[model samples]
Target: MRPQRLSDVVGQQHLVGPGKIIARMVAAKLLSSMILYGPPGTGKTSIASAIAGSTKYAFRKLNAATDSKKDLQIVAEEAKMSGTVILLLDEIHRLDKTKQDFLLPHLESGRIILIGATTENPYININPAIRSRTQIFEVKPLTLTDIETALERALTDPERGLGKLPIKLDDDAKRFMADATNGDLRSALNGLELAAQSTPPAEDGTIHITQAIAEECFQRKAIAGDKNGDAHYDVISAFQKSIRGSDTDAALHYLAQLVAAGDLPIICRRLMVIAYEDVGLANPPAASRTVQAVQAAQQLGLPEGRIPLANAVIELCLSPKSNSAMVAMDAALTDVNAGHNGAVPDHLKDAHYAGAKKLGHGNDYKYPHNFPNDWVKQDYLPAGLKGSEYYQPKMNGRFETQLAEQYHRLRKANQ
Candidate 1:
């Protein structure tokens, strides 16, 4: 059943749980303009539906993938007169800058409670002006537990679920189905329904779905080149691993396969990531060279672009590799995610603003440029994170060699 209430909604606890911002908004009936950003089938639309269902407000839906300015204008006019209108804008990034700009006025005026959904990051896809005007909440992908619960409800709920059908799901089939769905509830349910429909009746007169039956029902292999399809991730993984494993031959093979399949840009990007992540400072040239490959591909366009791509791949395969840089960045990002954010140091605080100096913004700040050899000790990081080294450059090429000499000199001079 399409859940009619928030309690019935699966996943998305951070937004709808007790005392959450959205929950408070719903209770007070103060639903404002918001953008829900996440991957497909993460219940962005369902959240909008729940909000609309709870109120005596007008509900209008528009898919930016299909709707034009005229459609938006019609909705805007209706919203202006209505007490409250929950306008669902799906794939709003499909709208050009001009069209996105057009919605800004209505959103700011509070005429429409904008509930925009995008699979892409809105900051990258949406106009900054419009993005600033709306509250953005990211919807996380559904977990396996969430999918299992939804499937259980679907199997038993007589009114809108599969209770009417002669279907029986074994534990293995249910587990496989959940894994295959990969957090997309719509796909999971669709797969289950398809399997149930195709499954033959068992001796007990119920349609029992097995692993083989499920696979047979969904056997049309999704093309490996389709970016929005299942093959996209698999191909990219194969390509990156081949390079990382120093298999230039296999790497070239996958590269050619991607090129022949016409997904050249994706291949270029995968190489770029490998350059930075796999090769890194062990050979800084890898990243520069990977960038050049992308530029060459853009310039020569196709057949000739293959030359630079090949050269870059071979070079990266032969180069000394290190993940030190990548590891440092990832570790720092993990800390940020864990909410270990420390405050800015006083010396590092901006002193350009009026009265900033009076507030001790730059008190005791040391100018490294004025010090001997431009080397001085000062609190570069926040007080709480003092002596916390994020980037411990490995002893490798240019970065390591230079850093080693500097550290030696600094130690001797300070002593």
Candidate 2:
């Protein structure tokens, strides 16, 4: 069901409620081109419809990817006749240069108040011309209470909702519908409608919708909508944090959540980052395997991909954790960033070029491979910043333990 006024919008009170941006625009009658971005079924269209209805303007809709320029001409004609028309352009990110050029003048002259809707980051995907003309707004996912309010309204509203049907929705069933959609109001409503229509009326002439029926109508469990949306990021953050915390079970739980969402690219990317950032030098072999597992996962798509991904996740969680490499790098980077650097020692400078020996470059340099144990103690740091120590190896794993021993030994010899 679509809202006829901005006040009727179920969620996004931040934008549509009293004193909000869109509401202020409608109240002041200062309509301008705008873009609404979020996951599907979050009232982008409803908000556009409500704005048009509230302002007494004609409402039109067309998909930028599928509709032709002829379709836009029809809306422009209507806008000319009616003075103003609110056009809801779906997949506005896909609007080509041709369509954009045709609509630019109408937007400039205030003939058409374009309400562009997309699931993509409009700033990155939309052409600069379109973005310049439109004020971008993000429609957030409906909260549990917000979805419940919409559900209740849909049950009793006779004009645009399934009011005539005598249906009994259990409390648990209602919650199932809300949570299963992950803040998608449209899917929840559709699933509810499916349950009500498919189930035959009971002996008392009332159709009962239970949680089990709701699940059946959903068919698959919640596949998170909008990979860039907040909920998806929350799950991903939890996934990486669990692995870093060495909680294998919790890590797998989050992994399963992401796998169900089917964002393989993000899964592979985050896993590789965790391998080096969280489980570095302490378990180099495990980190290396993590990289290989991600490669294998990429080769084999989902279902099979999940196998290698799972192995990588388990190994990373159980491996001895160390961030010493990351810490060391950060320490060095900090010095460089803060202007704690100086000119390289002449001995360390290249002497291959002509006249380099006259500049004293490499004149005192001693090759480390020619010395005992392929090592030599020398002043590697510049004179102004002498004896700088960056690496502090952790004795968390066998490899790093041996590395720490050699590193300290070299330090002692230099001293």
For candidate 1, what is the lDDT?
A: 0.79
Off by over 4 Å in 1: 68-82, 96-109, 127-129, 220-279, 285-323, 326-345, 370-393, 396-402, 407-415
Off by over 4 Å in 2: 221-245, 249-305, 308-312, 319-415
List, residue by residue over 1-415, the lDDT tens digit for candidate 2.
Answer: 8999998999999999989999999999998999999989999999999999999899999999999999999999998998999999999999989999999999999999999999999989999998988899999888878998999888998888889899888776787677668788999999988998899999999999876687679874433432223465678899999999999999999888878856687789899999999889999999889889999998998878999999999999999888999999999999999998998999999999999999999999999999888888888887877878899899888988998998998888987
Clashes of each: 0, 0
What overall lDDT goes with each candidate model?
Answer: 0.79, 0.89
The C-alpha TM-scores of every prediction are: 0.69, 0.64
Q: Clash pairs of candidate 1?
A: none
Residue 332 accuracy (lDDT) in model 1 = 87
Tens digits of lDDT, candidate 1, 1-415: 6667777788998998778878889899788888899978879988888888877578888988788889888988898787557899998777677668788788888888889999999989887776887899999989878988898889888898988877788765665566555578888888888887777787888998875565555552223423233454576788888888889898888787776554565667788889999888888867897898888896897777888989998998887777888888988898889888899888888898999988999887888999877878665666676656576666757775676577666555544
Model 2 scores worst on lDDT over the 10 consecutive residues at 220-229
TM-score of 2: 0.64
